[model samples]
Target: MKKIVSSLLIVSAFLLTACGSGNTNSSSASSATNSSTEKTSASSDANSGASEQEYTDPSQLKDSYDVIIVGAGGAGMAAAIQAKEAGANPVIFEKMPIAGGNTLKSSGGMNASETKFQKEQGIEDSNDTFFEDTLKGGQETNDRDLLRYFVDHSADAIDWLDNMGITLNNISYSGGASVKRIHRPADGSAVGGYLVDGLIRNVHEREIPLFVNADVTKINETDDKISGVTVSINGEEKEINAKAVVVTTGGFGSNEEMITKYRPDLKGYVSTTSEGSTGDGIKMIEALGGQTVAMDQIQVHPTVVQKDGMLISETVRGEGAILVNQQGKRFFNELETRDKVSAAETELPEHYAYLIFDDALAKRAKQVDFYKEQGVVEEGATIEELAKKIDVPEETLKATLDTWNKAVADKKDEEFGRETAMDYDLTEGPFYAIQIAPGIHHTMGGVKINTETQVINKEDKTIPGLYAAGEVTGGLHGNNRIGGNAVADIIIFGRQAGNQSAGFVKQ
Candidate 1:
């Protein structure tokens, strides 16, 4: 039944393309020209093995591949590798000059269930607990089935990454989890970049074809089934066919238009996602009659640098940092989930908070030296001098410090539950104030997919030959997403979509 519906849609789309070609010839020609130019620029890297010499633009690419993966981020790369491993010819298409969407900037920590790391730490957890925590965090708007699938498959995805030579340190930081399941790369660089590097290496080893700077503008469908894609490379338009097309172009965290339309609160705020995260996959999927879930749900990172759009990893707070307001009073518990922290800070005067830490914390935290070298911190021999340097009221800061010091000496945080109460006082001098504000980080809503990760249409019908994974498909994170869940969601569903799609070739 699925195959029949897909075939009918394919035939219908071919007819429409043929009939519309004459009337829209000029538009089609322009699109083709733009696409060609972009492709030429992308393939111009001679050292990367791409020929510097120009090649003739093919009128139409032979419309058929076993699998076509869109957006070369974590999900797309995972799907491409999975399809290739399953004996399928997988082609990956990316619009950006470089692959890896928002994932490139991601912390790369993933939440998984019952992992060796968790066991090693003696932290007891299960998929059931993960599901419950996720649904609670999302306020029950998340699809239970998809959430279950995510929890169940998360550990496998981590193992898969390890098998692919992606090194993840077994350190567990705090987030929306009952135990320590979050893993990061050993090099401590961007997690998404590391994942992409591994996937790209695997793709190259497998000799899979990848077309960068190829923007898929349209998904050609007939009678509700997908046929091919109309891609714009450079300025040239080209028609490419595929047996299965996976839309993993990520969410619209960076698109102000979409952000304003759906999540108005995040309109003026900076986003941590990559420049290519413009909801291309969401718009394309919606055009194909797919239904989107939780379109208004957006994640806000609590500790983004106000002057520059750099992510201040939550690990700082998880490791015992504090957030203070202008009055130098501790605002909220830093260990709370990002949404809660952002919400608490939003209600305060000026929607801005300062991340305060002493010399001990400064030396122990990751990226502390980087922050100091970047001049985001103020070093003073006295707390009064530090306050003056950061432009905070010295008296207010001193008073706040006295209260906090007493609390630390007593080994109990009266205002907020700070776990590891360090004995270092501001009297030792050298205080730091990194200005932080809530920034749009991730979109928790996108194309609705079922447990099988198949794209569901507005009519509640499955779109044959159409599948989506990663941030492109919603329902994993309902209203708010936990810290490590984003990575888990992408890789788990990415591989699922790939494994399912590899077996989807029409006889």
Candidate 2:
């Protein structure tokens, strides 16, 4: 939910990199890039109307509608589309200058199971395995009903996107997935821009009256029932009446004050979230007596450019990259869940590690090319040369590569118990390294919700006429979020919120 910027400029900025401005020219750990690198920015302009379309002015907004969707990210847009399809009048309000929020920064693909894409690829998968992995990944603290509903409906979400002309047939691995469930664009480009672009196109086609720079300050209620919302646009406040309101205003990972309030231990950690992700919807819902869960359970992604505040997607590790400490030694499984991998990094001598890969991986994963273009990637024609570039000891780096290649050949990992993503070794040159440390990524806690996407109050009763989806509402992720699940959460539940709210309106 960025503010005060032009719509076209903001969208262009998201295309430049993940988040934030400025570049790092230093060769040391000072410079950085992320997996969320928008290499498709050029194509995005040509393909999506997000940059070219005119946003509805505040004067044009209706005094009343069947559904008022807050935040024009993926979730809010999805809700609006579904509401229109369900025979309801829905309008979207985005506080930011642009529509896509942190959803645009996502690099890892959407997670789903038992999809036709997976079946065609001969990859055996099931919702049971997905549910088990997610429960384990969340440390088994997730709401069982919510998790069950999520996994069962994820494949439908994939197909839903497909129906909108967004094909995510490029399947790959994400940490904590039993099989290759992370689905990306068919060309294997990053998924964030692709999904956001597609959703924006659909919203445009439906004439959903999506308004940017329109912030919903308060969710109004009358007689303990949803009545309307108070919105501020261009320094003018207006009360818009609505039968239902959907809060999809994302999480507060980017808000330092809130992050410190909930988790004082993470006071100085850099964040990879969008500036608009200040938990606005959470605060509004909480003021309405809504309940919250796991507020302090903020997640710091393992691979982040500490200086630039950019997130390196876990797809790198999931695609066979390795993590090595300053001493050029492997410590833990690189493909472990973000929390565990980040925890292991904290135990290192310098509390940071380098994601090591070779030309083989760089050729396959397009994000590497973006990293190099940003000057964050250090390259060498040989292992020893790369070690010198990144300041790692040459012999130790060489020995580490040798041992890893052997393990790859033997098809067994005895050191740290890594069993997947061993498709290739580090023999191919030139080698690459990016100095990374943990950065605040996802806020696993927010306003609590039920499987129906209804906002639950402190009394554990559903808040009438109030529904939320995406990072704004929590309990689906529990204590930790698995990669690719966030996209699934927003789309699946956004549609559910729209349908359920529309149904409630009809009743």
Candidate 3:
């Protein structure tokens, strides 16, 4: 177990690609980095679910373009595609050998309200309700303007992806959501790899220039405006000129130095973010006089398999799994906000819990099936047998399941007030349990950005020629990020940044 943990850390630090706003499965890391090996038509095997994405070598790129995008994750790629569609020449540079960052490992789904997908399934929803739910989920600390814009434009972003031949028609619930607003692939696979593959394919189809292993060292400014960036390719520095620069380099969740600098309490905790998530864009923008917000608001996910530092997606709980302690007793509401759930877990005797489900979930959720295949899941023929396997009190486990199954059937969680995700009962045979603990998952704070996706300076003025989106920019998620909102943020703000940057260049 120790060897596996050590190897995962080492792989994430150097070779493996991390999540943009998702969680890591070591196999997901390999799938992300596969792009480094297959540059032209970078087609990954079944493990990654990535189609061919053509990328250029550093030597093949032009010295200048209309828009220069740093980071080739979902946000960067989306920005590039939008800029190209807006009649601007955009070039993307990814520091890692691979293109996808943490986005490659996103197992959950994108959140969007008032989408055709929802209406088709008779899942009634509204943008206003989404805003209210998200605001409350973040403890009313999110920027109202940004939050409003996100909810309003999320459905359009879903449509945009749909137009690009990437369909997220499957809808489900996520923690902190009031309804089934989380959209995933029709087959209910992980959304991270699927979204990345679709975006990469679109970028390739557009013939947009994308380079891997190209690190942007500096966001250059000329005459108090964005000029371009200084990048290192093949260990040599090169200056690339551009009319506008979009920094979508993700957040700093994986940067222990940065995390310790801000929240020292999380210094030793394992992070589920991609190693590339080191706040490079935030630091670069700050050096250019940009301001930051909520720099200390890092969020830890509630359910992580600590042995390999793999994140068990919140979708699991939202899909009807329960968290039980060492004594096999259910604790807090399984559908509560991540921060609350994480705090609840810490209050337990062992500071860890097992996510218990049944064959219904194992067959329903693609992630659980993958976990089972990876041998991270323990199984037994029945609930009592599962308790024995996990070394919990068999009687206590049986009683807990009996009570919880009754609650599901009665549609009332009288114990913990779990009002959502009670659509299923754990009555199926061959129950499963995955031991979990909290791990650093997301950085809720970053360089400040306005609704236009322009970087804000210390004076609260827009930084000319500089824009950002995704986890690199703060003010959207506030104190905590809701599940599925990260994907919404990247797409909605990514498109805005792309359009706004192109417009800036046009000026």
Candidate 4:
């Protein structure tokens, strides 16, 4: 928590000093550094009733294209754009009703270092610092080479999006980050809708073919080369061929069975992702003999409404709110990375916690009223009432509040070691609280890939004509993914995959 506040302050000061003027493109080629012999074991052929289907209807086969991308999310859209820009006739097939899958559902914030925004703000952030924070956040179990590559190229990825007019302007501190690299558009909503909108608009402007409601069920491979895909489009099976296929279908956060298989401890926890993120592409590639890495390393966003499971963005805590366990005691620093915070909360009996704040913090975060509208916010004139409303012991809650208030008064969090409290206190009337728990947010594991974005098979070799990016591909975020890094990962790797695929087809 102290680390986050200090970094935010430093970064904010840097932004103010720099005045957002010196933007640098952070995109670069990833070093081909994965020497860990790909233990890419083939997955079971049977999964969720799709892999066993017959692919014999030659009439169902469509004409071949240069590149075929699955999923119309941020990564898929980026891949298609880059593929087209690289002179390939690329087509994107989306399972959703339209383009913009879970990417639309994101807060739309992306992490980058040495960006003009950081420089403009006078923040002393760099790719090196970003790399270090990521490695530590992922517990250093991550592929160091991949981590180095991601940080090295993130700034360029942001610039690439900016060139295409898909730009996010605002910056803030985020979970598992050491500095203020979370960039989003000035949209008061702060959802990834803007990023998705910008990319979708670009897709339309470029006249890229986007097929919605097309779910890829099988990846057709002849010998060692991935030839095409079989997708169920509008209830009819159709075969689409391309020299190269990129799977950007995201992770299986919403798949109950997959979640249970990976994390049985979180079966009852809610999911804060799209239903389309059922790891369709992961399954397709795995069935094609791709190796999955760190399959058990699931990510759970720290807080969400207990009932409907709506995500209350981390910006809430970044502003002024603080979390307390069911006993109304502050358990861990609310500003800890999502994994650590969630792990602390899971120690409680019901796997639940609460976020308490005054109306001031709520207004600053621009979410309390929205949460109130959702009927998830519980308010009170005093701490006792707030605790009672949430069904925790009032005295316990009051003492907890007392300790917190004392810490605030002393300008230190003795119990949890938090930094500045953002100068807001629970003493303000109309205080609010919400019951929350860690909910499955991202699957940090899937298909193994090389730095060039080629999907690696279980035999420690690239499956020719195959590529992937976004959450579906693993080896980027080893044990856990940072908040804004997901957006960066999708776009950066997506562009690389597209460009590489275009080169492959031309060859």
Positional deviation of 458 in candidate 4, in angstroms?
1.2
TM-score of each predicted structure versus truth:
0.83, 0.92, 0.92, 0.83
Task: Give candidate 4 regions above 4 Å deviation.
Answer: 1-62, 381-385, 391-411, 420-429
TM-score of 3: 0.92
Indicate the residue-level lDDT of 196 in model 1: 61
lDDT (0-100) at residue 338 of candidate 2? 89
What tens digits encode model 4's per-residue C-alpha lDDT throughout 289-341? 89899989998888866565567778777665788877777788987888999
Q: Candidate 4 — worst ten consecutive residues by lDDT sum?
A: 10-19
Global lDDT of each candidate: 0.70, 0.82, 0.83, 0.72
**Candidate that would win on lDDT:** 3
Candidate 2 lDDT, 1-507, residue by residue in tens: 122222322233335655552121111111112122122131111111224334554556679999999998889988999998999989898776567777877787899999999999999999999999999999999988989999999999999999999899999888988789999888666787788878988876777777666777899988878998988764468899998999999988877778889999988787788767888888899899999998998988999988777777787888899999999999999988989999999999799999999998887776676677667789899999999998989999999999999998988888988888887887889999999999888888999999889999999999888999999987888888999999999999999998988888888
Clashes per candidate, residues 3 or more apart or on different chains:
21, 1, 6, 16
Q: Counting only residues 3 or more apart in sequence or on different chains, how many pairs clash (N, Cα, C under 3 Å) in candidate 1?
A: 21
Candidate 1: residue 368 Cα off by (Å): 3.6
Prediction RMSDs, each to the true structure = 9.4, 6.3, 6.5, 13.3
CA lDDT of 506 in candidate 3?
95
Runs in model 2 lying further than 4 Å from the true structure:
1-14, 21-53
Give Cα distance to truth, residue 397, candidate 4, Å: 4.8
Q: Which pairs clash in model 2? A: 1-276
